[model samples]
Target: MGQFIISVGREYGSGGHYIASILAERFNVPMYDRNMLDQLAERNGIDAENLYKHEEMKRQGLHRTVRGHSSSVQDSIAQLQFNFIREKAESGESFVVVGRCAENVLRDNPALISIFVRGEEDAKVERISRLYKLNRIEAKAKMFRHDKKRKAYHNYYSKMKWGDSRGYDFCVNSSLMGVEATAEALYSMLSTYLKSKEQ
Candidate 1:
């Protein structure tokens, strides 16, 4: 069987993780997300929490302050994580990897499909508020900040912009279609694509 890698880029509180998990279940494949940090920590002899800290960008005002520093620790951890992602992709196991620039990391691999999941701002705010138990206003502010960091992180490490349709095979709006429906749609699309590749 041909291996497949599905990379999901999502806006916070869009139920992106839920969608990825359901897709992995439907395909009987592994799902990699924050678990990737654990693997990287084990492989590099670093604390997993430390890896998480650098995985996303620092707050907005702090960016300028950290621009010029040569932080070998973060760089080494990122490289190790990239290597681990590549190794997993080449392992012949179909998997869904959320974030971590998996699309860029595995760009050279022809078997990969990159997807971006987004939702309307109001819907995202509602979901975030319920999921995180925050007020609507707080959730909205948090979502905005989170997306900014995610965009900066992706742009800083990869050539593609986060949530940019041009960078992905599919760009889905989960607000219009619920997470379950979105997962099913992606599965159908991916199955068809893989079958054609085999032909």
Candidate 2:
């Protein structure tokens, strides 16, 4: 087949980023995550660390825009990132992009394969707790906060709902079989998909 992109959208603490990384390794392609912001920052002379810290923050007193109008700094940065993602797609590179509304940004491309990952609430909380050294209650709270921000950010930037199964070509629950197994299953499915495309 030709160049294709794996665009993954996921809920907080779902191991979606880890899954995306595995798929990228299996496919021997680059994986784009929040690090895209660093590159964008460098290119545009922005502060990378500050951008990372505030990338998903919502600004008060600002309304969403259409017709190329951006009323907030976050919106401007998002537009720049979207343009960067489109450029990467146009460059004929096969890669996996995690979040940043990549599913919608590359929606029109035939090479796009969008995936959404979610997990059971308990699983998410546990994962977050272990990863960040927080207690279960704190982890649950953090997860909710992150998910809320993600939902808002994605909803504001894309036409589709974040983590909505209807918006993705494949939606998987990482909790059902754990993260590694989930990644393996997805990789197998993608392998079959690639073969079908070749035929």
Candidate 3:
């Protein structure tokens, strides 16, 4: 088996993190998420807290940028993160990365499997409310806010539209069978697809 990569893009409150975890475990590969940014910052002498605070979302014009840089701090950090993702792929390793525009970064890799996970509005609200102990209205608002940020961040950096089915190998609705089943189904589909590719 050659190096394989799975880049998961998910909506907020859609159990994307959990689904990515399940896929990583099933594939027996390491998964990279926001924490990877912290590792990158530590290794490169960048401020991890500042990197995380503005991750995935761009800074507004009024906000102060990272010290000593004329450009947006988020843009610089995003480039570093993209480089890290490419280095990992070039190392001939199989891994999963959630968010961070990884799908676009590795779009040229033949073994890359990009996925976007979304769910029904009501389902997302229910999940968020339960997980955060927030009321349904609050959960819905939070979901909208997060989705907007994610969309903006992705659109700002990538040529493809965020969360669009055409941009991904698979776009699944987790509300139908929940996270566990969705992961399992995707795992099976990927397994078969890889086998077909081998043939």
Q: Which candidate should be chosen as best, given TM-score against the real structure?
A: 2
Worst 10 residues of 3 by lDDT: 62-71
Q: How large is the C-alpha RMSD of every model relative to the true structure?
A: 3.4, 1.8, 2.7
| Backbone clash count for every predicted candidate, in the order shown | 0, 0, 0
TM-score between model 2 and native? 0.94
Off-target runs (Cα >4 Å) in candidate 1 are 58-70
lDDT of 1: 0.83
Two-way TM-score contest, 1 vs 2, winner? 2
Q: What TM-score quantifies how close candidate 1 is to the native fold?
A: 0.89
Candidate order by lDDT, decreasing, is 3, 2, 1
**Model 2 C-alpha RMSD to native:** 1.8
Task: Assess the local accuracy of residue 170 in candidate 2 as a C-alpha lDDT between 0 and 100.
Answer: 99
Could you tell me which 10 consecutive residues in candidate 1 have the lowest summed lDDT? Answer: 56-65
Tens digits of per-residue lDDT for model 1, 1-199: 5888999889998888899998899889999988988877787687888877777552233222266543455555556667778988778778999988889999889878999999999999999998899999999999989998888878877888788899998988998987788888888888888888888
Candidate 3 lDDT over residue span 1-199, tens digit each: 6678999999998899899999999989999999888899889898789888888886567644467453767777888888899999999999999998898999998878999999999999999999999999899999999999999999887889999888899999999999899999999998888778777
Candidates' C-alpha lDDT: 0.83, 0.89, 0.90
TM-score of each: 0.89, 0.94, 0.93
Query: What are the runs in model 2 whose C-alpha is more than 4 Å off?
Result: 63-67
As for model 3, its CA RMSD to the true structure in angstroms is 2.7
